[model samples]
Target: MSGGRAEGPRNIAIVGPYLSGKTSLLESILFATGAVDRKGGVNQGNTVGDGSAEAREKQMSVEVNAATTVYLGDEFTFLDCPGSIEFIQEAANALVGVDAAVLVCEADPAKATALQPWLKLLDELDLPRFIFVNKVDRASGDVQTVTEALQAVSQKPLILRQLPIVKDEIITGYVDLVQGRTYVYRESGPSELIEAEGDVADALGEARFAMLEQLADFDDHLMEELLEDIEPEKAEIFRDLTDNMQAGNIVSVLIGAAERESGVRRLLKALRHEVPGHGTAAARAGVDPASKETVAQVLKTYHTQHGGKLSLVRLWSGSIAEGDVLNGDRVGSLGQLMGQQFNKLDRATAGQVATLGRMEGIVTGDVLTGGGEAPELRRAPRFAPVFALALNVENRNDEVKLSGALAKLMEEDPSLSVEQNESTRQMLLWGQGDQHLKVAVARLKSKYGVSVETEKPKVPYKEAIRKGVTQHARHKKQSGGHGQFGDVTVEIKPLPRGSGFQFGDSITGGVVPKQYIPAVEAGVREYLSHGPLGFEVVDLAVTLTDGKYHAVDSSEQAFKTAGRMAMAEGLPQCDPVLLEPILQVQVMVPNEHTASVNNLISGRRGQILGFDAREGWPGWDRVSAYLPQAEVGDLIVELRSLTQGVGTFTFEFDRLQEVTGRAAEQAMANAAA
Candidate 1:
């Protein structure tokens, strides 16, 4: 490393909204740095970022792609993260190990709303970041407006470092605010340095002064120099920029179009001079900097076709080599990963990200130490699933393999989960969105060789009685010398809303024997499993007022049959109703979209409890409502669409409420079918 900086690679994550050209930026960075012989295009499906078959088929990033390059004698690893909100977990997981992030965005002000979530996440991590307003060549508006729009969503001040040079209403080049020089774009390679004249020459001073003013907010020396109207030395100004950026005090903004490889070298130079080293990331992740132990945290996990499992990890404190025992598992191999390619490493030191092979028991976000003690490292937060699908194995022989395949998928991606719904009798796969679950299914088929059928998960509906009834029934059979006889009289009544199922007996002393009472209760419970409404019965009480048992032939099986007969005869007489699970939901969104969320809940036949400003979150609101489970299946998709993909919610089962009309009719029809 130069200038006395620590010797290690600078890990940076390229993140933004969908189609913001993050993968394109990685390709350009690699090509510009000579790490790759030629740049690859996203549409051509030859880029190192989206190399997976699933990503190529969808023409979008489905996971995090790591590529390494060198610029100006400093090593850098660029993690090209998926930009779609559906795959945001990939970015969240990768960011914990990175030194900083480059947030790429379009120049359109209308799309500024999409940057809020990414900004909020970066602020939470307190990671240094820079904004690259991409596609300036295609922008139809002024670059200042785009900078202002970005500033509105970011918590840190956005200091614009470049001024676009516009000609005939099209952006042709940019003036470096720091260097006080102008450059013209070269379509195939690095931009050409040019002399500033006319409009560019006149506008350079004001823009540069404005950038220095923002930087001075956190630097006392710069503030004094600005106050005295004295120009600061260029080296001093660069020092202030690097110091503030590494401290997370300000965000440096630059302009570029990654598809054309414009400004990529300039971007790399900025990174080389300003980006914090892996030491800063290790300290930020709560790793003990003074400790000499070998600690590494798994950032991502992948189960390869023929290579078993490979865990991408960031070594925090010491070096590790192949065959080292980490967290009770032997490290089979160690290497650096570039997309699908692996470069074998003799040893990996602290602050370097490496891939460990065959870490079978290890998972994403797991902290491993070769010293046998696990370090407490910061882990990525697990997102609550917002979408679900019920799976059916296409081949009966694959049924035994589904669980193992799903286990691997969940291991590779902590955001994915699987559940067995006892009431609905369906195996449900839960994820962030419909596309998220779809990609998971594709992986199961392609990667694991397990074909499956998927459908929307069935809501677990229940049944409750509206009234009470008295009924009597008997079971008698005469096949041989002894006959089976069981007679009973039961009083069935509806209880309170959440009383569940209650069973009691008030039989006279000699009429029914004591041994037969539990059998009768068991019989009642067995019948309740499927009520007249074709659902598990709940919120009702049953009393066995009287019963007759033949001394010779009466049995628990006979009494159970008698109880089932009585329920089949009595429940229809009482007004049977469908009861659906109601969830207590708290929907959190930006205050600007609060009104839309209220209307959304009402349209879904929900009851709004109240709404208030969410604590600790400024300019956001939490709306509390009671929503039916059936209506909640696709609520997240609509909520995100309404709030620019920033809205989310948490829910729990509150109670079972009676449902009628078309919703109840549909539930009944589905049950019958």
Candidate 2:
């Protein structure tokens, strides 16, 4: 590891959409800072931040990876977050503890548009951001065109820090606008300042003037000097840009080919010179559980194979040390994380990330402050499970072990949820997408030595009446000592949708007597809970008009039998209908793929509620639709495949729609079988 004097670390997270080369950029930064001997590539599966097995296998980051590097004698701790939306919450959590963000973007116009949400998030966080236009070496588009496309999606003023010089589609080097100097990369791997002449000088001068103009907006003196044609000092320009950035008034855009390490060194140098570190320790106000004192936030929790549990924490105020007991809002064990492992640190100071080991009763979003007060931390990102699957242990005897393994998996990824439907008796695992669940199951086997089978989860369906019917049922039995006799006349009527089930006793006094009335209602409820169609019965009412009971053998059992028999006989006569659940879904995809998504939704018997272009998203739109739950089982898989893994959606249970014709017959047949 590289060593440097710690003077208030500047924690910055690198974030963007997937395949925008975020991990590659991080690797280049690590190499440029001399923290690593050589840069690692994603394809080679040797990058530091993309170290997880799942990430390596998928050639994409699956979690947040942190490391520290020194640039220009300043220490900077960087977090490289996964780009897939399935793991986007990881990036959002990292955002909580960071001071700023470096938003990486691809040169493609469409890819640049996909970064709008990330840019908007940074804007909302009010953190100064720098746009790194990566993959310049392989870009076929013009730099100016890409910049314009980016500007369309960004609300902040985008100030160009560097201008690329192209020769036959090759980015030879970049001209530093702030320094008014041009550097071309030589075979030796270091940039060399080259003298410009003629048209080249004019073009460079024009670009320099544009950058100077942007900086001048932050300083009246510079603006006046520019109007007077008086030259401004290079140091003054740098100061203005840095000040504007810190104030969140300007966002600097830099161009580079991170894979080739072309302008990576310059980018790092700029970060060190421009980005400011934390100023002072102050008590960050947070809700206190024990008392009313303020507290700090817990940003990350890691479960390592060798390191145990580590809670990467950021102290907002006061002081914390080893053995200093702290309580979390939610009950859990607390521990500090260290480099894929955790150790109990004796103590940690404010504004520092420390690993606390084996801490009981702690969680990721818990606060620890003075006076034994612990408050709930900020809300974590919540993405509804858009896809689900029923899972069963391959070996029947391993059921409990499989459940335990899944619990561990859930602990690692809070986005995942597991539940067993009582009516269907299906063990379901829900996640953001197919890949998300696939990875979860893989982890279950690899980490816990548990194996399981997965299939499309069954939709929780119901059977309801469309019309009313009246029927009579009787039960009579005679045994040696006693005789059983019961009879009932009941009217079953269809209730309005969502009214649920209701039972009423309208019988006259002394008819069946009030004693056995409760028994009849209970029986009706039991049968409704599992409807005549073999599913739960809903949206109906049953009323008891009259009944008879034998004086010697009348009992609750006899009445229950008569009630159930009456319901069984009257339900089939009332025109039962199978109701399937529908889900309201919002799908986000590239504009080019929007039509395809609409067609796919229609094919699934979905109704499009319409679509609108998303704000600040240049080439994307959000499509609103309602689809049958059954059709959405693998919708995410098909969507990702269609959009090259750039599409995502969120959905929730909407309402029940009646299945009709052949579909209803098939469902009923399957239920009966």
Candidate 3:
């Protein structure tokens, strides 16, 4: 493979909603560029982007995959990103390094609505973008209708660059609007420019004029010529379109059936002429790292089969070679990524993407320059692990292997985390959703051969007293010569919420000696750790009102025993109640599904706080509410079910709410049983 720099080495990310053929489009682009002999279908699980076992089984892109291809003498690096909302962070990360985006949209208007969030993200980032109407042959709607629907969501004016020629439900070819050329796909892989004829010519002329009118917005001379009824020069029209595209004023829309290889050649040619190359990328990204300072952004990290770990980085400036020192350390090895495969290289130049092999302490989103200067280039996307599972080694003897496997899994996906809960004695793994955790477990077994069983994680509930009570406990056990004797009266009171546990010595001179007071408090704290309801006790006060101790045989042990007994007797009598942690949740959903989302929240025992219309997202509302932590396990599934998988929420720990009556009783009964 040659590493020769092309005219414009542009990095573009293909992003859209779930099942919108983002991966398929990349596969088609790779095949069309002759990088792959045969295209891999997503259903068959053989696509390049979905190379992981979990992705193969699910037939979805779980992370970002960067692949480079030479299209029309221009080296194009395409980042194929997952379309599922759970993996939107992957897309966000890919967008940070890329200069532009190719927002793939399906022909269905309903399906196109799912791309609005992605479009909004692109607009916020101020990145240039184009629209690719994929799966045109299979779509029921016409190209013009789909284009109009897409234009409504796009912040920039979307101009059609290619018009599809349909005949009896089959698209033969596309008319190139810029050059006024009609290309018809031959039987094999190539397309030949044919002479325009009849209705095709008329349709082509109308589409070409519409494109020229949009292109004229960026060129004053062209606009004046168009207004004066003079045809603008072809070079001027193309120049205006390219300039406006770079300025993020206009988005070019192209129609093609990626699977059938229709209009792909024209699309590639358009990308070559319009997309920004390496020089443009470096200029827009700012100063070159080698000349002034070193700057390279880590786009992604991958764990290979034999090559170990590779951190794929985009060099914004400065040349990185093997043994070149950076950040007070020598660069280990420079390599290039071919899907999951890594190829060792001598060095990678500025304005190029290269795999930095065996980077000891580097992580995703890290910017490593020269002279011990390392800054974080981009903010990591918000990926909270909401779902959790209690994991245990199946063999019980592979505990070390299980720990190692969990660590490796975390290294691969920062979103998945594992922790050991000391009190519960359960190893827990948390992720974005059930599927996310399940995939992590699968990777553990497949990659490390560590078999583990998982179960629903336990909720950390608490117990609190509702009233004050006075209780007495006595420990008077006589065993042979030494007799154990101790007595205490504890004034147990309910503290205000969040007051926690309080201990005070109400005893006067030598009643319960100062030395033994510590013992009594320790015993009370031990009992408080595990309440009568089998949960931690919180927000209460325990004061030692009065007590008696034997001077001869009564020790701190005896007094501690008596204190534990007093707490056991007093807690149940003070109207003990169970408290579950509540999470304040804010769900963002489409306006049409607001009622359904509200009802779903109510059904989950959520307390509605307020609702407001989202600023940029039209026909969307953000519903803020509070729900119990226990009710949040499957909330994402339910919200997706209610809103056609277009809804998302963020939640945080709120104040604890008491669970009383039947709910408290049932919880206690279950814990006891």
Candidate 4:
């Protein structure tokens, strides 16, 4: 707690596409820092990053993992986030607490398309990032071509800091362009320094000059020095690199093989020199670093099998202790998380990632101030759900416990949502994709003791009558004490679509008394609830024309009974039809996949309205269509496959349309089943 900032912890997030070796990179970094004696493999299910049982079973990360280590006497906390498109919410939330990020990916240029969304997000947030070209040992082409491909997707200019040294078509080492030195990758021990004055001297000069030109864009003095045929000093070049990186003007590109720990030391060395201090990151996140108050924000949350709830937070200012009050709740324990393990700390300082135990009401993305209350945290609009499932408890006894479990799940991932559809009488859990729901189900069983099942939600179909019919019915009964008799004639007619239900009285000379009219309408409404087609009736009108009632025996109950009988006899005489819900969908995808998206809509029996370029999204199109509710259950899966997990849509219930022919019969049969 001081006015001046120190070179403290560097909070960096490891993020990339699925199967791009992000977890491998985290393991390599941890091992290089002497945090672990041995590196674990993903196939062996022994890695500290993906420690969850579900993740180990699937061989992928489903949530965020945090690990802390010390390098060069500065604390470094690296967050290993999920790489799957389905679990992107974890990365989006994790980025909020990180001071910087390492964008890991394969060396294949074609896979560069997958990095577009992630780069776009980082640029939008103005977060400094570095590109780690993983799997360079098996890269397909030269480094220049791959770097050019990657530059197409990034908003900031990419400065390549190293080049692969190939011999016999095998990458054996890398040349550091800035330091002008060569380091060979050896599996036995540390990388050995090789002389750059051999056959590689010419190639090294060209590469280093190109890297310097990138830095010269921000430094006029360097440009003048270059034009005057004078080489700039090493200190001047380092200043330009550090200044541009801290200002988010350029991205530093490095190469490494995380699986073999190749080039890992060079990556760490570059980070120690360039990564900014806590004050710079706090300003980037819109927090005033000079404020003499306790300010922290929760980035990710989890529930352990025995440790209760853990709120993973990044301290922006001041310090927090075990009993410190935050967001109106006292921190039960002060702990530091290393993967799945926690070590209690007496107190945590600014710029450190700490786990606050048993935060009863705190959720992900919360910012606590000195008042022990959460203040408003502004953020971008959240992504909408692209798939949903209707949830059911395996044992009905768990029905009462499901809500609490779901609330905790939502607290962990705000992108997930739940809504009880009253019209369909279903509890639907909405998420990004099928895998998201699968992980949720696993969490429910493991953490909350609630077993659940999921399936496609039922469509809320309605029925309406066509034409008109008039019928007369009488309810006559004789009891031991009294007699009951009531007669009524009613007319049933169909109204315009969306007209709803209406009832009118047109009795002549008060054949049905005013007192009994209310009961007659009540019976008509009760029958309308379930029509001849076994669905809620809509868009119809009913009238009471003529009726005969005895003053002594005709009570409201008798008149109600007569109304019910009349409706039963009249509604059948008219033709009834089913009406299914229609949704107006707006699908967005890259323009290259527009034709495929159009085909998808037609295959699902959807009518294409039109298409145009999406506003604010370059090279993307927004296509509008009208699709049935039943056909939308699995549309997201096909759309993602067609667009490489980038296509998305927004839809709402537009109107009800008539269902005829085979579709109507199938719907009726499904309802019966």
lDDT of 4 by residue, 592-659 (tens): 89999999999988999999998756677999999999889889999988887867899999999998
Clashes of each: 0, 16, 3, 0
Candidate 3 segments whose C-alpha is farther than 4 A from its true place: 1-8, 283-286, 289-293, 328-330, 397-403, 419-427, 480-483
lDDT of 2: 0.76
As for model 4, its CA RMSD to the true structure in angstroms is 2.8
* Model 1 whole-model lDDT (C-alpha atoms): 0.88
Where is the poorest 10-residue window by lDDT in model 3?
Answer: 1-10
CA lDDT, candidate 4, residue 89: 82
Better candidate number, 1 or 2, judged by TM-score:
1
Q: How far does residue 435 in candidate 1 sit from its true spot (Å)?
A: 0.4
RMSD of each: 1.8, 4.5, 3.3, 2.8
Error (Å) of candidate 2 at residue 609 is 4.0
Any residue pairs clashing in model 3, and if so which?
289-293, 289-317, 290-318
Which one is best on lDDT? 1
TM-score of 2: 0.88
Task: Write the candidate numbers in order of decreasing TM-score.
Answer: 1, 4, 3, 2
Assess each prediction's global lDDT (C-alpha) against the native.
0.88, 0.76, 0.79, 0.86
User: How much is the lDDT of residue 288 in candidate 1?
Assistant: 74
- Candidate 2, residue 306: the lDDT equals 64
